[model samples]
Every structure is written in structure tokens, then in C-alpha cells.
Target: MEEERGPIECRVRVPATTTNFGPGFDAFGAALRLYNWTTLRVGNGGSAESLPPMVQEAAEAFGKAVGEPIPSFECAISGEVPCARGLGSSATVRVGVLVGLNELRGRPLSRGRLVALASALEGHPDNVAAAVLGGFTISTDDGQTRVALGSQLEFVAFIPDMEMETEWARSVVAQTVSLQDAVWNLQRASRIAAAICLRRYEELSGLFEDRWHEPARVKRIAAWEEMRRTAYGAGAIGFYLSGAGSTLMALAVGRGGEVATALTRVAAKRGLKGICRRIQAENRGAKAWLRRPSRRLA
Candidate 1:
């Protein structure tokens, strides 16, 4: 094949999300206040000079998976999520890359298809489902969408410093959960899904307390107790594991200055370095802006 370089760029928006919302494991998910912005370009491209490592890592992974390397591209990846902090960092990058690539390829893949593809690679649906579909999503195995809760809520995430590999966190759980614990998750997940679909944001608080996973993982994360205590003291409505552990997330009253300050103090005192984000519960999913070819209409 001859060398070719007809450059094109695509813009994409993807949001942060919390999975396992206390009780729902690999089942319940919620979109949060941060987002990943990126543009994929083919051929000669400009520079960001400060692309996040997650972004670079994600691009390389995408290239390997797709059987084609990421062509010369100008990509700017910036977001509030700290690396390895359980705030859907990987999902956002994956969605952003897939969105850009699809637009470049003349929009060949459907969003649903792309969602399944990303979820398969991510090894779970909690994060990717929220990033793609937005709002709340419930997926078991892969094909089943038992519940799809379109966005409807207000949330402010108190992200704490600390990191844990998802695999390491996963290793903490019991191979078999107690029968009662299983039933408890089932009930809360059902209620949470119903509340999301009905737009009953107020009821979400009850649904966020889990009986299956967070307790187990919190044991491994050093800052778990202090983070939770401080968040509740900060007037958070509810809280749960964003994904696995270490990256403590809380659903606070609002994404306002006071709430942020309270969480910041807590993080500082605890020595966990990270930022606070006023994440909007968005269900708009992945949207792309196409860069039209520069033309002369003289």
C-alpha cells in the first residue's frame, strides 16, 4: 500500500462513573462529575505536551486490540480522575478512542455494539456501561441489559489519593458470598434500578449501601475508614466503592464550594492527594463533533 495521509479529527465527551454503588456489584453503576476529552487525528498532528498517562496507555492498548496502530494523531487527554483511583479513567479513554475512530471510519459501528466491545475488553460493564449509555446500567454476563436507568441525579465525588490495581482489589473478595448477602444485593439493586428509571433521585441514598463487596475491599485500602467518616460528616447523601478500592467516592449534597472544601480538608489531613469534582449525572453518553474538511467555496 502507498503512503497515505488524508488527516481528519474527531471530538468526544465521556463522563466518570461509580460502580458497585455500595450494594450493587458488577450490577449497579452511576455517572459522575468528571469527563475525558480527546481528539484523534491522522497524519501530522499538533502536541499536548502533557497528555495524561492513562490516555497514552489507553491509546496503545486500543491500537493493539484493533490490529492497527494508532496512526499519527494529536490527542489531548485531560480529566479530573486520578490514575488507578477507581473513577472510570480507563472507561473514559476507551470510549473516547472508540468514538474518534468510528467517526474517522465513516461511523461504521453502532454505539450499542461499541459498548459491548469495550465492556468485553474492560472485563466488566459497570464503568463502560455508564460511560457509554450514561446514567445507570445493569448488565449481567454481557448481552442482558436487565435495567437501563437513564441519567437523573445530582452528585459530587470526593476523590481521595490512593491507588489499587483492580486485580489486587478483586483478590480480596470471597469466592462465595453468603446467601443473605446475595439476597441483600439483589434487593438493593432492584430498588436502585427502579428509582433511577422513575427519576426518583431521593431514594438513591438507600440503594447505595452495599452488603456484598465494598466492605471486603475497604479492609485492604488504608484510607477507607477516614475517607468514609469524613465524607459522611461532610453531609454526603451516600457513598460507595467507585470501582474496587482506594479511590474513595461519595455522593454528596451538591457540587458546590462548601462541599468541595470539606472534602478537600479531609483528603489533605488524610494525606491522600487528589481533586474534588462536581460531576453531573449525565446520561447523554458519547457524542462526537466532526471536523469538516477545510474547503474553498469561492
Candidate 2:
């Protein structure tokens, strides 16, 4: 945590993100208040044996992107964001590593370049872009990412006991969607951006319905239909699968606690052990800073 400039050290904190946002699949994303933290200490390239999988993957990607051998750095990774639940835990690691290394290397890569590298590493830009840029984001495959600043909103996150890997969840979705379904999502995605930016919470209920991914993937989560109904019955403005899914997000203006309580109760009654958390949107994105040691007294 020291701020004095001395031996090279960098710390990066990246937020967890929820992407797709119902009909906005692979396009819309918002950064949540939850975050993951990673720290890097520069030295000779260290052993890769013990590094976390995401960290390892990040390092490899960074080396390739920068056209340099990975430096020896001891890394300590920790965070509150849950993994394998579509919360961008992997993005946190990938982004943190790239950002941390960029700092240690005197930041040769521009932010845009870094983002492209991260997106390429992640196989898409949705979650990584939001985690890197913060706030609400819409990113395309062409390396263009946009952020829309707006009033913050609350979310009641129902984290189930089970884990659904993103790859598996994605595999269940159909590769080709109907033109009508595509049109259905296009209209709603545009409006969703306005609704979120304008704080029109009421407009979200209808806009949050999706025909592309949810119907196919919701079956993977235990009692998802029942939970959706329960959330609506409990006064949620709208709800959607958080990413690919074992975690559900219920949007609310002032009823976060009530919504969370209701979801937790329903989960318990259904013999599914899980907890609910009420979190807010984070406007700022990932942050990286050097933590140099304090100079000794002369």
C-alpha cells in the first residue's frame, strides 16, 4: 500500500461486470461495485507453477501482445467477486495483469491498445470493456467501445450455490438466431441504453425480456423461472441473468433489500443454498497505481 517511489510494484483493481443485459447479448454491459484486486512485484520472470489459471493466461496474452517475454513478477491475487458465475472474474485478472505490467513497463501501450489486447485475450469485449472502462458500456467486435455515464442504480444479486461455467453456458445457446428475434433485441437494446442513462427504471421491465439467450440457458439454473416470477412479485422493476448464469440480477430503485430478502427466502424454500447481495453501479473503471517503498532517512 505504500506510495513512495522505489522498487517497482503495481496494484490493479478491476470491477466485476454483468454483460448481455437481457436482449443486449454480447453488446451491453455494466460495471458493478464488486471488485477484484491483483498486485505485481517486478523482478526476474518467476515460476509459473503456482500462478492462478487466469493470471497465467493473462501473462501469456500480455507477452504475446507486447512482443516481449513475460517478466518475472510475483503476483498476489485476491477479490470479492465470485468466479465461474459470469461476473467477469476472469476479466479482472486479465485486465489487472495487463494494466499492472503496462505500469511496470512505463506504460508503452495506450489505453485503447490495452483494451483491444484484453478483448482479444478474452474472446470478446463485453465484460472486459466494462470492467476496464467502468460504468455502462457497449462494445463491438471492431474494437470500438463506448461508455455511457448515468445515474447509478441498485441491483439485488441472487448468487446460487451452484456454479455454471461460462463456456458451458455459452455452448447451450443457439449459434443462429431468428431475424425476428434479432430485430426484437435490437429495438430493446437501444431503448435499454436510454432507460438506464435516463434513470427510467419503470421502462426496464418490458425491455429486459430476451429471446436469444435466456430461454435456452435459464434451464441450466435451478428454478430460474420460479425465481424470475418471485422477483417480479416482490416488486423488482426487472430481472435478468447476470452474464451466463448461476447468478440472477434484479433491478430496483429503492427496494434492493426487499428484493434480496425475497430471493434469499425463495432460494431457501427451494432447498437451494445461496445468499443475496445488494450492490450499486460503479462509475469508475479499473485502476492501476505504483506503490513504491518509502525512502530511508539520510
Candidate 3:
């Protein structure tokens, strides 16, 4: 055991994701470059007696789900994804935990299996699908099938000052929406998917029009209209609420800075608090790289 005093460490790159694009509701998901890096160190091979209690609990929660014993080690996590926003913070964390442990275990979990488990933990497929697959993925409620997300589009997600929790926000949706609104969303969702496939950038702005959820969400969030105008006027192919509220994605065919700057000013003027940054979607998902352990930590 003294020969294994040190731990095995690894790094995972988990990208930020955009879900519920326009009217896709629970189906569509896109992966982005904005990511969280999770690094973990596992204790050397020892009996089940080697692990600590908190580490044991986390490992049990994450390990049994993967059909394995709880990892025998301690973990440290740090990164950019924020919690409680529409930006999928929970997905990032869960994926990070799974990836960190899997790496230490000689990659016992395959990529596809990891995605399904991540989706199960997240309670939704959108965010985890995008994070794991690194592109667009369509997942069902059970999260068994993770189809490759087939979109290579460039866009920016607008994050607003205020954060909206999905639970609280979702509770407000009426049990029955009008038929006209539902029809509008169905048509738009179809068109948006088609536009993405054909690479019809110009058609994007019109296709992003969602009559189902955004209209209602926008009414409550003060930052909606101004951010929309700023993105629209800046020649964004389209813009929409990223997930539920706060983050709004603007399409910039080639005008990345233009959209970021314009949205920044608009959000500031409204007396809202938030940050605006440019991000591009990665057709690929979670990735790991092996490097020499840092001397400082060593």
C-alpha cells in the first residue's frame, strides 16, 4: 500500500450545451465550447476498506449506476458551468463526476453508456446528450438511444443577469395551450430542423420563431425583448431562450463580435445583471486528454 500512496489523476472536457432549441421542446440539443474541466485523483488499489465514507457515498451514488463498485478515492471539481441557470450546470457536474471516475477505472464505461446514465441522473436527455456526444443528440425520456446530433452551426447563447429555475418556470405553463400556438410551434420546430440540415443560415431567423414557451417566458423576464432586438439587429441568423431563461443564443453566421458587443450593451441598459460571451457548438462531445501530472500538486 505504501507504493501506492499517490493517486491516479485525469482530466475531462465537458462542453456547455443548448437545449429546447426553439420548439423542439424535449428533443433537440446542441453542444458548445464553453466547458467545465473535471480533474480527479483516486487512491491506489486497496481493499474496499481503502475508501473514505463521503467518497464512498459519492462513488456508490455514481458507481452502482454504472454497474460497478464505488470508486475508491477522493475527487476535486472546478469549472465554468453555473448552477440554477438554464445553461445545464447539473448536467456538467454529473458528467464530470462519471468521467472522472471512469477514467481512473481504466475506462470501464463506454461513451454511449455514460451518456445514458448521465441523462438518467439529469432527469432529462437534452443537456447530457449534448455534453457527452459533443454535437446535437435526440434522446427520449428513458435516455437509451443517443443519436448523433447532426448540426455544425455557429451561434452565441445570451446569458441574462437573472437566473430562472426550471422547476419554478415550468410550473407556470398552462395545462392546455391554445391549438393555434401548438400548431405554430410544430410547424416552426420542423422548419428549424430542416434549416439546420440544409445549412440555410438566412432561413434561421424566421425558423427560430417559437410560439409555445418563449412567448410566455419572455413576458416574465425583463431582459427578453432588448436582448432579442440586440441579437436580431446585429444580423444574427436567429436567437432563442437557452434552455428556459437567462441565456439567449444568437446565430452569427460570421459576426461573432458584433452580436456579443450589441447584446452586452442592451443587457446593461436594462439594469439587468449578467455576462455575454461568444461560443461555438462542437460536433463532438466529452473528451479526455492524458498529460503529465502537475508538479505543484505532486
Per-residue lDDT of 197-242 in model 3, one digit per residue for the tens? 5666567676677777777777767777778878879878788888
**Model 3: which residue pairs collide?**
133-285, 134-284, 134-285, 136-149, 158-248, 161-273
Q: Using lDDT as the measure, what is the rank order of every candidate, best first?
A: 2, 3, 1
TM accuracy, model 1? 0.78
The superposed Cα distance between candidate 2 and the true structure at residue 8, in angstroms, equals: 1.8
lDDT of 1 by residue, 147-251 (tens): 444333446566556677888878777778889888888888788677667766567765677776677777765666776666667667666777875656666
How many residue pairs clash in each candidate at the backbone level? 3, 3, 6
Q: Global lDDT for candidate 1?
A: 0.68
lDDT value for model 3: 0.70
**Candidate 2 lDDT score at position 29:** 84
Provide the global lDDT of candidate 2 against the true structure: 0.81
Segments in model 2 whose C-alpha atoms lie over 4 Å from true places = 1-6, 148-152, 293-298
- What are the RMSD figures for all models against the true structure? 5.3, 3.8, 4.0
* Highest lDDT model number: 2
Cα lDDT listed for each candidate? 0.68, 0.81, 0.70
* Model 1 CA lDDT for position 212: 64
Q: Per-residue CA lDDT of candidate 2, range 115-216, in tens? A: 788888888898988888888888887764455554436878988878888888888888899999999989998898877767676788767889998998
Off by over 4 Å in 1: 1-5, 44-76, 143-152, 253-262, 268-272, 292-298
